[model samples]
Target: AGGQGEGNGLTQLPCPLGLVVDQLGTIYVTDDGNHRIMRWPKGATQGSVIVGGNGGGGQSNQLNGPVGLSFDRHDCDHCEENTDWVLASEPLSHSFQTVKLTHHLLWTVDTNQ
Candidate 1:
């Protein structure tokens, strides 16, 4: 239901290049034009920006023309259970990064290289 618009509306997507879903049925989309990553829960009407929402840039907290997205699970010492991570590809910046989903929170990755 998303298209060319903004905010929490169903028409907030300008250019979406990639998307992935977690085991919990959470939809993650790489909104290219907005230079941000958005998340929508199952049966939800609106989506929320989980990362790169500040604007398009090369900074760790920003994304430039994000294109692809994927998800994987990894074990972590800090937590007793396995955690989910989302892999994002910013083609315009030639950068690839990972974002960890910890306790339903978004943990930005360190893309310092």
Candidate 2:
């Protein structure tokens, strides 16, 4: 139920939650029901798993019912300076996590966003 024609590829993602588009027209989808995030490139047959182990809420880098995801760096201070950061929200844990794409830094925010 997004738009009229494009983006909807007839492949229904159960409990489809998070949504984001990269530069390559790849669609990032957080399939909540499956407890994992998936990505589907434009004109792809199926999605590829990106996160999770189909488990409940925990603090072990596992996803559980993740609702929202944002990769936009327009407002991030150091993002424009070539910092590859991604913000993902986990409502179940009442926290947000910042992931660095280039470097291996995982920072979790306890405050709600």
Q: Against the hidden reference, what TM-scores do the models get?
A: 0.58, 0.52
Would you give me the overall lDDT of model 1?
0.58
Q: How high is the CA lDDT of each candidate model?
A: 0.58, 0.49
lDDT of 1 by residue, 1-113 (tens): 38546553445887877776665677778777777777788888887776676666655566667666654342110111122444454432435565655464334342434
The digit string of per-residue lDDT tens for model 2 on 18-77 reads: 676765676777656555566677777766665553463443345556565545333121
Check candidate 2 and list the clashing pairs. none
**CA lDDT, candidate 2, residue 88:** 54
Candidate 2, poorest ten consecutive residues by summed lDDT: 74-83
What is the Å distance of residue 98 in model 2 from its true position?
A: 8.1
